[model samples]
Target: MDIHDHNRRAWDRAAAAGERWSAPVSPEVIAAARRGDWAIRLTPDRDVPREWFGDLAGARVLGLASGGGQQCPVLAAAGARVVSFDASEGQLARDREVAEREGLELELVRGDMADLGVFEDGGFDLVWHPVSNVFAPDVLPVWRECQRVLRPGGRLLAGFMSPAYYLFDFERAMATGECVAIHPAPYSDLHSLDAAAREKLVAAGELLEYGHSLEDQIGGQLRAGFRLEAFFDDHWSGGPEALDALMPTSHATLARKPEAAT
Candidate 1:
């Protein structure tokens, strides 16, 4: 099965089902953003530091894999020229819904995150990516594409699940709160789950996730020429309750492409 196409359909179902991430931001939120009182998250709970964005006024921002009308609209309200790119048409529709309602201008593009060839090289000043990379089977290409599209000294703000979060049997933990370590890092629902289990997930229209390691999540950015600047941890309120209380299951990072030599 094609992971990208399958995940796209899964996310479309998720949007239609009113998944929390699929919910669009309110007009009030956009109003606050215009008044310089806006905050957005890369992780689940913690707001990304405002300093990370500096003055968004006129900044060329790419909302990478970030549709569903959450971050991009707010950034646009904050004066950034924003483009939102995602694979799911439903997700992009939410962004458009908000854009139309709030009178915000947004460039919405739908495609695989790893293949950002639609965007020109050094075309953006910032890439705001939330915790959606888990849906991608490979992240190195995504990182490379992010680096390529960013101007020198541009920032890449990204969030992702902690590698260890996938070690447990999530189904068992959610039902019984028993965090049985059944999987390893770099896990994939396609290869990690048995045929019966995988079929059940697909039948239910659930997202097929990948557990990418730190080497691919963080180190991949460095390998792609981003310099790590700041980082933070956040917990998912919707995740297994036992594990959510134990430790942070996700992280956000601030990395920058090096300035060109004079």
Candidate 2:
């Protein structure tokens, strides 16, 4: 199927879904990442702390597929200048209203993730990709452009679903565990999401139709000219082990481009 049609449908679904506009963290199968205690999992890097940003002040940051402009406020609050892009006009409009009410500002661009030439080369100091790429059956093209627009020595931060998620889900049980191969150390493309699975997820209250693994998470960044720096595996959910067990699985990766590498 054509990718544009896929995204257009996605935009429609996400806008009508009450979940995206309503909460900071889902009450089920997920915990807040920007919140929560340290130690059930990894702590934020001293550098990536959500607090005051002596570092991000005046630095330009790009938020990819920045739905609802959630992180845009965090970046702007920290003093980083931010530009966010999303395919959904309704979602962006909701974000703009929130920003206006909060007295914060974010530049919202409407575009498909696959093409980002609206921004210049070496333009941003930081590129933020969070919980967004899972929508892409393919992440390489989007990532390549992310690399292109990042200045030499700039940073790329990615928050993506971990491959481990597939193991516990019934997808593995039906395959008699053969589907378990989706998660592995040092990897790339997670399983692709067909439209049926997408529909099921939407029915299940998930705004997104797919999930990705560590390989797709970390490897894609590297392939886009980013060198892996640090990785955080979040197992920290605010609730007890039941919902916590199904809590989102993810890796927060920090990568950088070498100032002199071609």
Candidate 3:
């Protein structure tokens, strides 16, 4: 099965079903952003730090694989020339709706994040990627594509799930009232789940997901030509499982492409 195509349809279904991520930002939010008051999420319930972003005024930014009208609209309102790229048509429509409603100028593109050939090399000054790479089967290619599309001295701000987040059996944890490590780290929807569980997950319109190691997430960025600048951690509410109470479930990083050698 084509994992990317499966995920695209699944997210479209989610968007149609009114998932929170599918909802567009309100006009009031755009107005506030235009007035220089704005923030966006890199992880659940946590806004990315203002310091992590470069100056947005007149910046050329790409909301990498980020659709659903959330971050790109805010960035556009904040004065960036923003382009939002995503795989799901429904998600892209949310961005377009927000742009038209708020009179924000944003370009929406549809494609896989791992293959950014639609955009030229060195096309963007900044790439803002949120917590969606877990949908990808392999993450190194995503990092490399992000590196390829960024200009010299460009910055990348990315949020991703911690590998440990996939270790727990969420259902078991809820039933037992303890975080039970039923799966090993570095899990994949394709390889980790038995046929029955995998079939059930797919039937529910849930995207297949994978847990990439920190080495592939962080070190892979370095390998793709980024200099790691800053990093932070975040946790989900303990609503799903007890894991969040013990450790962070998410991480974000700021990395920069170096200038050409003198």
Clashes of each: 0, 1, 0
Q: What would the per-residue lDDT of candidate 2 be over residues 66-185, giving only the tens digit for each residue?
A: 656355655665566888787777667655755675566678998888789899999999887765665676677877888899889888776666655543434553444232344343
- Which pairs clash in model 2? 187-215
Best by TM-score: 1
TM-score comparison, 2 vs 3, better candidate? 3
What is the TM-score of each predicted model, taking all chains together?
Answer: 0.98, 0.70, 0.97
Indicate the residue-level lDDT of 226 in model 3: 96
Note each model's CA RMSD in angstroms: 0.9, 6.9, 1.2
Tens digit per residue, CA lDDT, model 1, 1-262 = 7889999999998888778989999989999999999999999989999999977999999999889978899999999999999999999999999999999999999999999999899999999999999999999999999999999999999999998899888888899988899886678898888899999998887889999999999999999999999999999997889999878999999999999999
| Candidate 2 global TM-score | 0.70
Sort all candidates by lDDT, best to worst.
1, 3, 2
Name model 3 segments beyond 4 Å from true.
238-241
Candidate 3 whole-model C-alpha lDDT, 0 to 1: 0.90
TM-score, structure 3 vs. true: 0.97
User: What is the C-alpha lDDT profile of model 3 across 103-173, one tens digit per residue?
Assistant: 88999999999999999999999999999999998899999999999999999999999999898887876
Rank order (by TM-score, best first): 1, 3, 2
